[model samples]
Target: MAIARPVRALGLAAIMMWCFFLWTIFRPGAGIKGPGDSLANLERDPNLDPTGEPEGHLVHTSDAYLPDANPSARINATLLALVRNEELEGMLQSMRDLERTWNHKFNYPWTFFNDVPFTEEFKRKTQAVTKAKCNYELIPKEHWEVPSWINDDLYKESVKILEEHDIQYADKISYHQMCRWNSGLFYKHPALQNTQYYWRVEPKVHFFCDVDYDVFRYMHDNNKTYGFTINLYDAPYSVPSLWPETIKFLAQHSEYLHDNNARDWVTDKLRRPSHNDQASGYSTCHFWSNFEIGDMTFWRSQAYEDYFNHLDRAGGFFYERWGDAPVHSIALGLFEDSSRIHWFRDIGYQHIPFFNCPNSPKCHGCTTGRFTDGEAWLNMEDCRPNWFKYVGMG
Candidate 1:
């Protein structure tokens, strides 16, 4: 009888253990939702007040979740690059980064233009890395050559003086040709004629964030005409006489100025719009052209075409080595409303000695921390800080 009692007690203990195991496996909100429930239960949460709200917050319900809009319904845009055969490797690195970060999802086509034909190796290597369609086209000679109107003697003298001063790319006539092409001729390229928007990429530029959304879609949806990452002042030595000429053109064409233009951002402390001063001068600050995503329509507009024609006739491109940076800046400041211009805050970009690194905590790929902070170059060139203030975004 005593042995039976002990055996029965042992069996009961085993049964109890088995029941507990089954309970753990199938119990309602037992192991699965305990931790999560504690977080979601406002009444039980320590952060909540007596009203079961998180301190000062009220109870609210959100609308039904919505799926993302079809990304394929994006704007007609292409990623455009102008490069030489020697720059193939550097361009490929940028292409790969862009692909992995954003274009892989969007599959936007890439159009590359070069003065010389792309070598077989350049085409094959670049095509292998990307799934999107790629087109390589040669630039027409007329577009890449010095205009016949420019006086050779004056151009040579100017280049000699700039080279003596050790100015950047001063001795290279090809560099000046490149600036001129970018200023007015690039949008006219037959390969780019079909697209309404272009995101310009240069050799060795870095994109250091996962661009989850379609930038082109944002531009199209918001009606943003121009987008830039870095804004800085041009070296005064590079364009001493350029701004005075711009002032001259603006005075002659006062009808073209927008109602709410970014005039204060471009002009010196001396501009008076009433009399339209010819000597108002420039602040020399320009949005760096190397990293631009803009509507091609903006550049192709009559206002921009007329502006380019006026500057071209002035012969500053060859005579003074005028860069396209200030030319585009001053034109956009006058012709477009400030609201049409956009600063892409999420894009992390680098073009030697300067970067527009994103400050968002969500940014994981950025090597530089913030656009305006910890960089010595911004202080050395005082345009970026002023750009923030001019745009009312400080």
Candidate 2:
């Protein structure tokens, strides 16, 4: 009787082991699904490619314009550029490079904004480059001009001080107007009312890599609020009161700050020497505004509007020459989660002296390692380390 009982126990244990092995092989995420698997199972599988492309498919430069490479769904987006009528040639060069590298296949529409009416020649020449629809809109006078509340005497004195310090564009009132307009009024324009996402394109900038995927769709599906290609320090002399005014706003409305906010990156609190030392306000690190891909809804939100109004009331835009770069950076750093702010490391972009040349196979007409190995000025202003450290990737 004892021997027969032991034999039955051994058989039962073997059967149980075999069942567990089968379960492991056929688990939900094991990549071994039957032909009869449900679509829900396929959607839930993380091992599958998000782009729906077959595994191991190679993407060449010519593949950028392939009809089959287009995304299955597209996000509501546009290529937005605020340009002058005189920059026609430079704008054309930028448009061609972007269309060649990425936009030809998807054919997203372009929206151009000018403080004044666009010239017929400028409109015709730009429209001739691509298959996408083109829009030209004039900036409203109220949106482009200095606010009524700005004290003229204070503003003039500030400009004089900036000039004495040899700050760039200090004596130009139009530059201040442009910075203020870009910071608070661009998204409010009538032309961009229906658009949810915008990729800002500036004249004379270059796109170096072949982008095989839809960036707007990527931003939407991935829940990214802001994307940038370059990071650098802002000129401190240009924004003397920006950080202080930002602090005052934060104090008044503490609830607006995100729980996973990148305050440390902007404040440089983590790298401070001691607790007793005064906290370093805004390390002057900012994302260069020239190459920005962002969701317009964030800028249109109440938090951002209130923040902008506070800064505008403080009169830094005209009083101290506050660039749009630092204003946007400070807002994102305080109000949004750091993870939602993306760095497009694969995109190769250049705006004159600065370059973001990623070491990728898809790039053309640019060399890698220029940010680190090529220029002394770029190295001094590089803010990637601070950003990387904040994100726990350094």
Candidate 3:
């Protein structure tokens, strides 16, 4: 029985009306919360006696957390970042949103960095909103400047290509400057220079979980290093031969390796097929270096620096548009190995085309036990170069 246009339209309208009624019931656009949350919140309310005491007062519906004090900051962390002077306000606003949401369930401080002075205004406004203890510092001059080994011709040529194509933000000179900063200087910031472990954060990123345990301390105690939020990029079109060059570099510079655990892990991973396990397979290499927590001394170690410098000298920073992904992945491969890299398999994260929620069906354990299934949460499982065992979530 084919329906006439009038009848069909009315039916759709009725269905849509029903949906709208449900939306009103569910309160759509009330922020990230969904109907399930209302029920959950209701269920939890009776458990919390708000007038009881400090602990009673501690209860809240939101998952966001804030720092308690300096010593408390040392216990757990919520390391945040700032690389550009221009984006300070936007970053602060994002922090404010996170602070507004997370209050004290996660009392972790923030660490801010810049290649220039953190203006007093930036500090004042940020503190007003975040309230959490915040530390601001300038990226030392050495850390901001381009390394001398960068090949001017190749670097310029690459930029010219991106610009000729009018690649997204490719023409923005400041972006390039910041990209360069990320490459050579960020990890070298003075405040973080001596710290054994730290988290790399940026303005405007979201924190949507109740994180009580000190992540850095967890790594420090367990002797794991190198955590990240997203997966590394893998576009062979970007640099076809660059991968081989990286392998060669690792082979030659394997001596200065620091973490025997990491080295063994990555070696085994390197031989494994990409997620698909195809014959002409690509490596299941992750390039999500946007957010990372790693040991300062390890990066500053002679061996690691030697490799970084060697690659920097090779002009990859400019030549191939070398991103932090390849740099971190290669370094992890050569230095720490699989056992050393800790993938925070359950941390909620978003980059593009994906939103990573740990407990969801798509997580570290999603695989038929293969890296291919990908991390629904953060996948720290031992990759093909499986040295780092993805310890089950905390």
**Judged by lDDT, which candidate is best?**
2
TM-score of each: 0.77, 0.79, 0.63
**Model 3 residue 53 lDDT score:** 14
TM-score of 2: 0.79
Q: What would the per-residue lDDT of candidate 3 be over residues 273-391, giving only the tens digit for each residue?
A: 44323212335455366667776666777766776666666664555555666566657665665455655644555433333344433222221222223341124422211222321
TM-score of 3: 0.63
Candidate 2 or 3, higher TM-score?
A: 2
Give candidates' CA RMSD values in order.
21.9, 11.8, 17.3
Candidate 1 vs 3: which has more lDDT = 1
| Model 2 lDDT-worst window of ten | 45-54
> Model 2, range 1-394, lDDT digits (tens) per residue?
3569888999999999999999878864343123222222222212111222212223323443343546434457999999999999999999999999888867778999998999999999999998788999999999998899999998889889999868799879889999998899999998888889999999999999888777887787778899987888776777767888888999999999998887766875333223112213667778999999999899999999999999998988898888888899999999987777877776779998887776666777876443333233223566655576565321
Task: Compute the lDDT for candidate 2.
Answer: 0.77
Ranking by lDDT: 2, 1, 3
